[model samples]
Target: MIRVYRIPFSTNVERVALAAAHKGVEIEWVDVDPADRSPVREVSGQDLVPVLVADEEVVFDSPRVLAWLDERHPDPPLWPRDVARRAEARVFVEWFNRVWKGRPNEMEAELRKDEPDEARLQALGRQMVAWLDLFEELLDGRDYLLGDFGVADVVAFPFLKYGRLGLPEGDDELFHRILVHWQPIGEGHERLAAWVERVDALPRA
Candidate 1:
């Protein structure tokens, strides 16, 4: 059996869990306290949850874990079958993790200020809309990223959950507040709105 150490409400941790579930891979989840990551450190030499321990091998990082799972359990693969599409999916995931994922932090900082910068906030809003527009273009005719439910969707879904479509159940209020500045899903992003609805119904581990 596979064992995973994770903390609740962590999008990164949820990424691994969702990918595992989509691949029909069963996992033994060990929830860890955010204040105390010693349990996670003991196995991975780092205080990071979403660490996967399997076959006496341990792996950290959500993207790496997803790759490891795909390599170990190829059935219902988490990546697209086509080599080119698979490469594109990896690029999308990398860009999302490195770039767009950090935008929320910047937005939240401005939002939490006593006197928020309206002009800067608007700029951030425009940037977010631009990013969403890219996703809208990507989903031109496809249901999920790359035309199938794969790792790209698994990674992007958790962050996109806090969109301005009003809070879904269990969404972080602060995150929703920060992310809501972008264009609403219902307004111009019809495909993304539908994609969110479609992916929200998928299974998670």
Candidate 2:
């Protein structure tokens, strides 16, 4: 069986877990202490959570693990079958990771200042809403981001779910404020909220 070293609640780790679950791929989940990463280093020479040790092949990084799962399992594909759609999925993941995902944290930091920049906060909030609007538009007349639940859903869910469902109890207060600022996944954006539920309802293998 494959073993995954991870900090269980982490979004990245959750991505791998969701992908594995979607594929019904059995995994030995080795929960790791975030404070001490010696085990991860020993296995994959990195401090990142979600290092997958499989068949003597060590794969770290959430995206790589996702790819490995798809390659090894193949059944119920995690990516779109059409070539163009596959490219679109990858592009969405890239933009989410590199561009959209961290805006909340940035907003939180700005909020912490003694004199928060109202103009800047408003700007960031608008930018955040624009992305949410894009997500809402993308979901128009479709079940998932790309017609079916696949890579884009797997990558986007862990973060977007919070906008609608709100964070779990004991989640960071600052992050809670951040989500409140955007409120991207609720009544106004019914499609995105529904999509979150769809992904949330998937079997947790």
Candidate 3:
């Protein structure tokens, strides 16, 4: 059987697991501590969660894993057959990676420390709202990001779900206040709101 090494409740892991379920690809899930490296490290030669092992070949990184899944199981294809549309979808995937990776970095730094920076937090909140606005405009009348359900939607769904949940930074009043700054995207942007619902209704692993 194919094997996947990942941590529970991890967004990236969840994304891949969800994609696998969508493709109806059965896998043996291996839950591992991110801090400790032994077997997964030995297999994938990396410390990252979501390493995919299939027989003699080991695939690391989420995007590559997703692409491999699409290639290995082409049914219920996650990408379009048209070359131009496939390119566009890949471009959007790259943009989403940057947004997801950079969005919470500074906020997470302050959150891990004793003293949180109020001004920085406010700026981050504003930036997140701007992101929501961009997506809202892009999804104005579309059911999915790439005109149809595909890998792009899979990559975007987990983060958008967080936004729907107000991008909770912590369990406190300030976090809720920060959350409120952008939580209205769900109600304000009709298409994106519906997109969230559509993705939320999908089966998961």
Error of 3 at 120 (Å): 3.0
Predicted structure with the largest lDDT when compared to the true one: 2
Judged by whole-model lDDT over C-alpha atoms, candidate 2 comes out at 0.84
Which structure is stronger by TM-score: 1 or 3?
Answer: 1
Count of clashes in candidate 1 = 0
Off by over 4 Å in 1: 109-119, 164-176, 180-183
Model 1 lDDT tens row, 14-113: 8987888888899999989888998999999999778999988999998999999999999898888898988898899889988887677787888899
Each prediction's TM-score versus the true structure = 0.87, 0.88, 0.83
Q: Residues 100-198, candidate 2, lDDT per residue (tens digit)?
A: 867877788898899999898888888888788888999999999988888898888887887877778666667665765576667678898888898
Pull out the clashing pairs in model 3: none
Ranking by lDDT: 2, 1, 3
Q: State the weakest 10-residue window (summed lDDT) of model 1.
A: 164-173
Question: Which 10 consecutive residues of model 3 have the lowest summed lDDT?
Answer: 170-179
User: Local error of candidate 3 at 18, Å?
Assistant: 2.3
Candidate 2 Cα deviation (angstroms), residue 49:
1.4
The segments of candidate 2 whose C-alpha lies over 4 angstroms from its true place after superposition are: 108-121, 173-181
Q: What residue pairs clash in candidate 2, if any at all?
A: none
lDDT of 3 by residue, 1-205 (tens): 8798986446677778778888998989998965687878888887887899998889988898999899999988887889999889888889888764465655667666798888887787678777777777778677887787888888878766655655445433433334444446556777777788888888876
